[model samples]
Target: MLEHWSSSEVDPSIRLDYWRDVAHNWVDVQPLSPGDALEASWSLLRGENCFFGTKRSTAYEMRTSPRHVPPGEDMVVISLLEAGEMRLNAAPGEHQHATAGMLGLYAPRQEACYHWGEGARQTYVALPRSVVLAALGREPGNLLLTPQRCALAPALAAQLAHLGLLARQPGRVSAVEYAGLLDATRALALLTLRNLGRQGEAADLPDLEENLHAGRHAAALRFMEQHAHRQGLDAAVIARGAGCSRTRLYEAFAAQGQTVMGALRELRLQRARAFVEHSPRLHVGALSWRCGFADPSDFSKLFRARFGLSPTEWHRRVWMEPALRRGA
Candidate 1:
C-alpha cells in the first residue's frame, strides 16, 4: 500500500502541529520556520523488511535523537537528493552538503540534523541495520558520495527512483514480486558500497581473490532470488548472470552445505508460500506455474511435504481457521 500525507489540506493555523505529528511518527523533527507557510508531502511504501519513500517540502531544520527512535527498530536510511540541497550534521563538528544527484547514508541510533533548502525533494530507502551491515560487511557511518567520486552513484540513484515508481503502483506488484525487487535493490546497494570503497578495512581486508569469490557468490544468490520464476533457470544461468564459472558457482553453494539447485528450489518454494499466504484466492495450479513449478501435481506434493498440507488446505487454514476459532 502507498500512504500519502500532505499539509495542504489542513488549516493554516494547525499545519505546523499536523506536520509535526506526521514527522514524529518517522523521526524527531521540529519545523524551524513554524511561522512561515509550510507545505510538505510524504509518500511511503512499506514492505516486509524495508521501505522506500519520498519527501518534498519547504525549508526546515530537523533533528533525530536516540529518544526519538522506536524501540527495537534499528534502521539506516539512504537518501538521494533530487532537487535543492541539504546541510547535514551527522556528528559533532562534521558537516556535509547533499546536493542534486548525491547520496547520504544515515545510521541507526545516531543523532543527526538536516537543514533542507526551500523546495527540497529527496527519495530514500530505509532498511534494517542488520540488512545494511550484511550487505556492506561493515558498519556504515554517516557517509556522502557524489557522482564525480563514485561511478555507481548514478546507477544507485536510478534504482532508488525506480523503487519509488514501483511503490506508487501497488496494483501491479504482489508480495513475492516485491520481495524480489527488494533483493535486487539490496544487491545494487552492496555494489554501490563496494565501488565507492566504503566497505572499510582496506588494509586488513581479505585477499583480492577471496573477496571477489565472496562477492560473486552473493551476487549469484541475489540473481537467483530475483529471477527464480524464469523457466529453465539453473546454475549455468546463475553463473553467467553473476559473472563466474559454473564450477565456481557450485563451489560457492557447496561451502554453505547446499547445492545450486537446492537453493533455487528453496527460493521458489519461498515465493510460493508468500503467494499462498498473501493471495489466498489464487488457484493452486496457477500459483504453481507462477512460481516456476513445471507440474501442478509436483508442486502440490512438494508444497504438502514442505508445509505439512496441500496448497488448498494451507490456504484454508491461513484464511479460515482464525474465523472458526473466533466462533468457538
Candidate 2:
C-alpha cells in the first residue's frame, strides 16, 4: 500500500496537528517553534514486512515519550539523508549528527529524540527489528553510517534514494516485485552492517527460531523500560504491551532467570537510584512515590538491598563524598 500526506491540503491553522496525527504512527512529533509555518509532504510504500518512503519537511522535533509509547511496533528505521541535517539525542549525554549523504539507524522501540532541519529530505525504510537482527546476526546499536565507517554506505544510500522514487509510483509495482525489493534491500542492509564490523559472519548469526524467541523478550524489555514508573504496571500489562501471551512473557523472562514482577521492581529501583544521584535534595518519600513504590519504607529496603544503602544514605553519600574528600 502506498499513501501520501501533504501539509498543503490542510488548513494552515491545523497543519502541525495533521502532521502530528500522521507522524504519530511511528513517533510523536512537536514543533520546535510554536506557530511556525510547517510545510511537509511524504509518500509511503508498505509491503508485507517493511515500509519505505521519503519525507521533506521544515524544522520540527519528533520524540518517543513514555506516555506515548505504544504496545509493539518492533521496528528499526534506516534513513538516507538527501538534504539538510539531523540531530539525534538517543540517550542522556549522547548526541549524534547526520548530515546530507549519511545513513542513519535507530530503533523506534527505544526512547529517542530526532530533530530535522528546514527543508530536510530523506528516504527511509522501516523494517521489523527481527529482520535486521537476523541480517546482522545481532542488534545494531544506534549510529550513523558515514562513508568512512562503511564503504558500502554510499551504494546503500543510492539504493534507498531509488526506493523513494519507486514509492512515488507504487501502483506500477506488483506484490511479488515489492517483496523482492524488500529482500534485496535487506541483503544490502546486512552488508552495510557487516561492513561496519558490527558482527561476525552469517554462520555466527542466530537461527530463525532463536531470533524470533529473543525478539519477543527484547520487545517486552523495551516496553518495560518506558513504563516502569506506572503504579499499576504488572505482568498482564507487560504481556499486552509486548503483544505476547502471559505464558510467553513469563517464558521469555524466565529464560534469563528473571521474573515479571521482579524485573519491574528492579527497573523501578534503578530509576530511583538515578533520581537519587541526580536530585539528592528530593525527599526519599516523594522519590519513592514517583518511582511507583507505595511505601517509602519498603522502597528504602529495596533500595538498600539493591545498592547497599538506603535511598537517603545513598543520596547523602553520593553528594557528600566529594565535599568530604575535598576537605580531607
Candidate 3:
C-alpha cells in the first residue's frame, strides 16, 4: 500500500506540539527554515508529502515570494485556483497571473512566491526536492511551470480536486485506501510531469520515425508480455530482442516512469493472475512454476505481496467474478 496522510482530525496546532508526531505516522511534515525544503513534490499530497499555499481570513504566506531556496533545497508547489487571482514571481523575472480554471507550478527553489488575491480559495500541493527530481529524471531546481493547456494538466487538476475532497472528508476513506490513492496520484503526477517536459520540446519528428519508434516500443512491450511467463527471460534477453542495449532500453522505458525489471515483474504477475482467475482449479505450486517462478514458495509470497492475496485465496476470489464464473 502507498503511504499517505490526511489533514482531517489533526490538531489545530499541528506542527507546534504533539501533533508533529501525528504527521509523521502517515505523512512527513517538517516546517522549513528560511532555506530548507523537501524539494519538488507531488501535488496529490499535502502537509508532509507536499506543502500548501491557501488563504484563510488573514493572508497565507509560502516559501515563495521574494524567497530564493539556493542551490540544493527546493519546494515545488502546485496550486489549483478554485476562485481567485494568484501571482507567482520567479527568477529570470518570470511571473504568472491566474483568473479561472488554471493549474500552476511554483518553483520556490529559485526565488519565487505566490500572491493570493483577495478572498481567494486556492489549493496548493508542495512536493519536495526528491519527488521533483524523481519526476524530472534530472536536477532542475529553477522554475518549471506547465499550465492547464497541456494534455496532462486536466488530469492533474482532477487529481488535486479529488485529494482536496479527501482532505476535507478523511473519515470516508480507509487509511489503506487513502494510501493507495496517494500512491496512484503521485505516480500519475510523475508520469504527467515527465510527458509535459517532452511534449513539443523535441525536434520535429518524421512521421515514419515516430511510427517506427512507437512500433519498436510496442513490440518490446509485447515481447515482454509473452515472455514474462518465462522466468529465464531477463534484461539481457529483452534488450537483445528489443534491438537496443541494456542502457538504451532502460532509458527508453524509464522515460515512461517504469524500469525494465518492474515491467517484467508486473507483466508476469498480471499474466499469472489471468491464468489463475481463469482456471480456479490451478494449484498454487503449479501456477507459480508456470508463471516463471522456480520456487513455489517464493511465488506464493510475491503473489500475496503484489495482489494482497495468496494464490489459492486469490483463485477463489477470481472465480467469484461473473465473467470467470461462466467458465467455472
Candidate 4:
C-alpha cells in the first residue's frame, strides 16, 4: 500500500506545523528558505522487506535527533536525488553535497541534519542492516555512491528508481514479485557497496559488469510487467524505465533469447488467461481490452496460437475438467 501526505491539504498558516507533526517519527522538518510557505509531499510504500518511496518539497531543512530514532533500529536509507541540491552533515566537518543523480547511503540511527534547495525531488528505499551485512559481510558506512566512487552506483541507483516506480503502481506487484524486487535490490546495493569499499582496486571487474546488466534486466522486467496493460508500452519506454539505452535493453533481453515485445505479449496473455480462468462470465472483448489488445479477434487468434485453444475454449476446458472426469 502507498501512503501519501501533502501540505497542500492543510491551511497555509498551519502547513508547516502539520508537516512537522506528521514527520515527527523520522525527523523534525523546518522551512529553511522561502520561509513558512510550505509545499511538500511524501509518498511511501512500506513493504514487509523494505520501504520504498519518493519525496518532493520546496527548500527545507530536516534535523534528526537521537530521541527521534528508535533505540535499536538497524536500517539504512539509500537515497537517489533526482533534482535540486542537498547538503548533509552528520558531524562536524563531515559534510556531503549532492546534486541530481547522486546516490547516498545514510545511517538513520546517527544524528544528522539535511538541507535541500527548492524543487528537491528524491527517491529512496530503507532496508534492514542485516540485508547489507548478509551480502557484504560488513556494516555499510554512510557515503555517497557516485560514479567516481563506485562504477556500479549508477545501476544501483537505477534499481532504486525502478522500485519507486513500482511503489507508485502497487497493484501491479504480487507478493512473489515484490520479494523478487527486494532480492534484486539487496543484491545490487550490496554489490555497489562492495565495489565502493574496494575503491577501484578490485581484481575482478567483469563480475561487477555482469551484475550491472542483471540488475538492469530485472528492473526492465518489473517495469514491463507493471505497464504491460498499456497498449503503447514499447522498448523505448521500457529502456527509459529500466535506466538503460534501447540498444542495451535489447542486448539484455536478447542475451536471454527473448524479445521485448514478445515478453510483453506473453505477460498480457498470462493476465488474460488468469481472468478467463476465474471470471467465467466476463466478455471476451472486454477481457481483450483489459489485457491491452486493440482488437478482440487478434487477441483470440494469438491466444489460440499460444494455448492451442481460443479463450472461450480454454474457459470451457477449465470449467468442464472436473465434471468430465466425474462422468468418466
- Report the lDDT tens digits of candidate 3 across residue range 1-328: 2223333434444432222242212222233111121221112233346443332221222334323344443556666776656545311112355655677655554444544444455555667767876776666443324442246877877886666666555367776676666666666667766766666244223366445545555556877866766778888898888887777677656544456776677666767777886784878777877877878888888878866677777766656655575778
- Taking all chains together, the TM-score of candidate 3 against the true structure is 0.41
Superior by TM-score: candidate 1 or candidate 3? 1
Q: List the lowest-lDDT window of 10 residues for candidate 2.
A: 89-98
* Top candidate (lDDT): 2
lDDT of 4 by residue, 197-222 (tens): 67744532447656766677778888
lDDT of 2 by residue, 1-328 (tens): 5689988889988888787777556678876443456899988767667777798998788886445645666778888988998878622222466778878887776678887877889898877777788765667567777675667878889889887777766587876776777668767876776676653343335677556557667788789888877778888998999999999888876654557787688778868888888884869788988998988999999988866678887777768876787899
- When 3 and 4 are scored with lDDT, the better candidate is 4
Candidate 2, pairs of clashing residues = none
lDDT of 1: 0.73
Give candidate 2's TM-score: 0.54
Q: What is the number of residue pairs that collide in model 1?
A: 0
Cα RMSD (angstroms) for every candidate in the order listed: 20.3, 16.4, 19.2, 20.6
Give the CA lDDT, 0 to 100, for residue 301 in model 3. 86
Per-candidate clashes come to 0, 0, 16, 0
Q: List, residue by residue over 41-94, the lDDT tens digit for candidate 1.
A: 877767777777887888777786777778777888888888898877522122
Off by over 4 Å in 4: 17-24, 33-35, 90-94, 133-139, 166-183, 198-328
